[model samples]
Target: MKGGATVPIGLTPEQGQLQEAVGRFAARHAAVDQTRDSFEALAEGALPKWWNDLVSHGFHAVHLPDGVGGQGGSLLDAACVIESASAALLPGPLLPTVIAGAIVLSVDDMAAAKLLSELAAGATATVVLPESGDLSATATDGGWRVTGASGDVLGVRSAAVILAAARRDDGETLWFVLDPEVASASVEQRDGTDLTIDVGMLRLADHVVPEALVLNGIDDDAAWDITVALSACASAGTLQWAVDAVTEHLRTREQFGKPIGTFQALQHEAAMLLVNSELAAAAAWDAVRAVAEAPEQRQLAAAGAAIMAVAPAPELLLDALTMFGAIGFTWEHDVHLYWRRATSLAASMGPITGWSRRLGELSKTHVRDMTVKIGEAEADFRAGIAAVLDEALGLVNDKPSPLGDYDHLASGPQRTLIADAGLMAPHWPPPWGLGATPLQQLIIDDEFAKRPELVRPSLNIAEWVLPSIISSGSEVVQQQLIPPTQRGELLWCQLFSEPGAGSDLAALSTRAVKVDGGWRINGHKIWTSSAQYADYGALLARTDPDAPKHKGIGYFIIDMRADGVEIQPIKTADRDPHFNEVFLADVFVPDEMLLGGPTDGWSLAIATMAQERVAIGAYVNIDRAIALRRLAAQRGPDQDAVVRALGELDAYTNAIKALGVRETIRLLDGQSAGPASSIAKVATSIMLRRTFKATLELAGPLAMVERSEPAIVAPYLRLPAELIGGGTRQIQLNIIAQMIMGLPRK
Candidate 1:
């Protein structure tokens, strides 16, 4: 969590320091044994000394203001501490205490303030709402009589002070504080799955005669927001522990004389668990930060937290246990303990169905706001671009719409007008681009997004290839290629993948012999998308057979019209001829066409591949998730199997969308996409496969016959291409593990 020049998404440097500090504290005082001992002590009507130690050490009051006998820090700081403590299996009273402290601090009750100061120093508190109890209170002369029962309240018996919400005769909910020690309250301990915290039922019979103890004003929204945020942090922390534990078990547990982790199935499963943990972490941090910085965004953030934390934590823990084999099932192992804790927390979170629906409802409006952060100038830029687009829309209004399958406008007056204005390639350098800053680029995106019908010409690889070429290609190559590519006058396809070398492109046998002021290329490329329609291709060939696989390569721009260059369509499973195989028998490339150094194709290819992955990862289609959800809603969730499948698809699809937002935010911040893009690419592919499969399943008999819903059946058939294209899912996982996770290669 420690930040450098570039911090991870949703976290700042100070938050990182807080996370590190809490991690160290957890390592020392909140391990598995400590958690077990805390449970044992609770059974004996004793509280763990660690709670007081935390208060004494100032960790308890980190989120409170200095005037309240605490350190003034953001809620994000509090969430970090909670996350780290949860990772160590720390008990739950601290979580409830921190949340209650925040709520009490927001009101103007002197009695509550005194109790909060005590909580900041060492005391623990619990808040029980209507969801947790049947509690009710009535106002009397100078005091209130409270009588109700609260069930499934964690740490209720252990907390010295309790905050309970009850409805009056007027149907209004009021918040009151109860001093359990002084009040006539009885606590009955209940057998629960989570051994780390004492869950019990609390009954108050005509107790709490004190108007002074009632908070002046109660904001249930603020209370729930704080609780949800802290609970999400705990879930994130525990999920991380489970993921790490399972990962370590996989690395060490061997089967058939080899480590189980070597198996691709286990690798993918572990990688998925890691992905879930990441989503939880990102969501939790976002929620906490929203609480600290933007109160308006709190509901959206809490919804994200509710969906991510409650839905995934238990499942991830169960996955970890499954990965651990029979040992994980045994009582002696700690995996089951984590599973029990997760299940208990999930139950307390109520129905996943409601939270999932809430998330879906919030996504439409909230996600757009979270995608980018723009300043005043960028806002002005957007307005200016909007005016220009309005004018451009006028130009296309009366003209015959030539946007048919065979007659789409690629290069016409409409495209030419926009391209000339530098809107086509805003990120590219001047003459061909505006060299717009990240904010300006986002502004361009905002403007172009308004006109969905005005399609930008698919320059294919030229979008990425042209930029790489501009950076490294000779002046002649840049001047001749950049302008035309920008103007949509040129169409290009990449010719890097060969039949013998798809993922292993460096091992390609494509030979390029140096000739008189040119090179004779003799090679074959396969699975080239749109190769049949390309005017030219960005090609890779071996110039030195003696050099190593990655070192002996050269890149060139080969004209598709050259002699001996034959293109044959490769029919896919969908019966589409969009992909083609090209045989370069003896194609000649002039010396000026060579890109970068002779032996530098590998480096350039890596650069290009990186950009490709980013592009693929950033391809967020909002309609895709919505369509699947609509399909599920039509099918209904009456059957458990269908409901399970639909829920899984929805969760994964939403996660992909979240990952896209993170990636876009990173781009807008001018940060490197790095290996994380592979993570997103892999997640997207998996989500797509599952989503389409679930769609078909939901359709039942209707799926057998092709319908006009080309969006559904067409994508299902073409999904294999996506899984194989832009690196296979397995290859992406390898990159994620090796490059991002730093796991040793096979």
Candidate 2:
């Protein structure tokens, strides 16, 4: 929500009707009970025939053109049916059918129409390739033998033709549509799901294929692109179906004394999953509609959407499963069906890592230029590096950050280009300087936030520390510190925590007794970010000896280069420290260095704390998490969609935890975007904890199924992260109570 597209797309009535129709179909047909057996059959080499029934009922024909023997409907219509079938766990050679239709659609003339027409009539059609283990017309004996065995075909036995990719002797890549039964090969029984469609090995030993079998008449690359696009659509459809099923389940299923769906945690999980489903849909939708966009752009967009897909669908399904507990995992339980579909669909499409690599490659070409990542702290300070990070409870940034990465900023009056547009400080009167309102200011912040690139420029952060100096220091100190700091004359680090002082802020024993014009400071701080680059720092000193603990502290802006100051980078679990450690041995801070009135430092510190919390919450990206869940949901049970669902849910919950911190940032800014952040933290934990609990519960006896490292890793990953982060659920509730509700703090 923080950086979502500002202008939303509204759907037409027809689209609404189409969606409803799809939903109705899912309601009537979704069945999870047979999911496991069917997938087991598929994995072992048998696929179901009921899948053929759905295909025959016009599932694949919904989107082909009228001349193609279809309803001549839109992609939206096709997707609706695909999604519905997925929700129901009906199996067909969907990959082949959709891929074939795509190849047919790419034809330049009546040939395409003819191909589509034949396929839409339920004639089995597929793409034959090395990717699918078959080749075009070329071989060792002069006639190309499409000699290869396709051990696993989603709907091969039912398919009259298959789409296969192969490398020619000259190394040219080609696709062919070959008939397996006719090929000089053996089709032997292999264990597959449900014992429906024949899942056999087709070993093409010198099997000849005709050049007419080539899908592409001219462009060799065309078929490949077609396959990618069509497969994306099918994957989208599968994910969407899982989303619908999970959404419905979340809305209806009850546990722990109420519909688990009603819980904020669950709803958020569902909401994120739904977002993923939308993304997958959007990817296919955009690719289909972007018949005009650049080929690479279209591919990138498709890849981006697909890459983020599977995790969300399956995650939501698994969440729903957990809510249903053991009943969901039972051979007779309804959830397994959706889970199975989700797993198979995901495995079929390829992994997210492949897509992410594509994304990273695309990013190299498309990343926008500007101050991103690092920024000058202030005017003339080129060495300065600054980025805004969300801090803990009661946290805040000392001033509006120096980073500006959002595109909209070029539209804003140049910072300092005009005195009217430039901001000086609380020092300048409203008449003499920028007089932006809180809302306007918030807009500036938001604009700075919503760039396609979310990071602020690293060149502008030289001044993040100057304002804190100006706010709480003496006149002499302000003159000595703020301006030069603004010029990047100095840098700063935060020396706040020690090993013992993590969340309990007031227990610090860092001493700095007043001695003449300066104070002697001694303490150790751990996990301070950016200390390696700082010339100065903000530190809290114990000033009061006998008064109440929190009230006796003083905030001091310190010179990092001061005598007795030391720094060390702290290593983290992931690796080297993003933050560092600082040890102070009787460091001297001049009297002018106190950040606020002595003992008033705690309140001054509150500003950055809240900002930090909200900033951290922004990572909660519910949308991102959901995208992943929907992806996992699209996988077929043949690939262990339920357990895969467990993996997906695990990923989604961690993502949700990041989002909750972002919401907290918003609340701290005084915008009541509902108590979603509070709700997010609470619900995320519950969803996470319960999702894992449900995983164990759903596994019933299978909780003991630690057959491999990967088998049970999903639940394990989801649970611990939920238990950690942002002061825990209990701590977050305390913030909500004390900060939002005016309740007494513990």
Error of 1 at 497 (Å): 2.6
Reference-based lDDT, residue 251, model 2: 45
Q: Write the per-residue lDDT of candidate 2 for residues 496-585, one digit (tens) a residue.
A: 666777756677888888898978999988767667767778787778968787898888888888889898876654353556889999
Residues 1-746 of candidate 1: C-alpha lDDT, one tens digit per residue:
11111123335456667777777776787777667756666643467766667787777788787877888876767777878777777765777778788777777768877877888778888888655678878889987888888867777878888888877767777788887776488888887778877788888898856777778676776677677777888888778787677766766777898878778777777777776777777666666666644554676676667777765788889888988888889877998787877777777767777655555444444442454556566666678778877766665322322222532335666666677777777777886777888778878876777678766544456776876788788888888887777666777889999998778998899999999999999988999987887788899999999998889999888899999899999998878786899999888999989888888888888888887887776554534555444544443554444444554554455555656665566676566654457777887787777677777766666566555353557667767877787898888876655555544355
Choose the strongest candidate by lDDT.
1
TM-score of 2: 0.48
Measured on C-alpha atoms, candidate 1 has an lDDT of: 0.72
Candidate 1 residue 247 C-alpha distance from true site, Å: 4.5
For residue 279, model 2's alpha carbon misses the true position, in angstroms, by 4.8
RMSD (Å) per prediction: 4.2, 14.3
The alpha-carbon deviation from the true structure for residue 112 of candidate 1, after best TM-score superposition, in angstroms, is 5.7
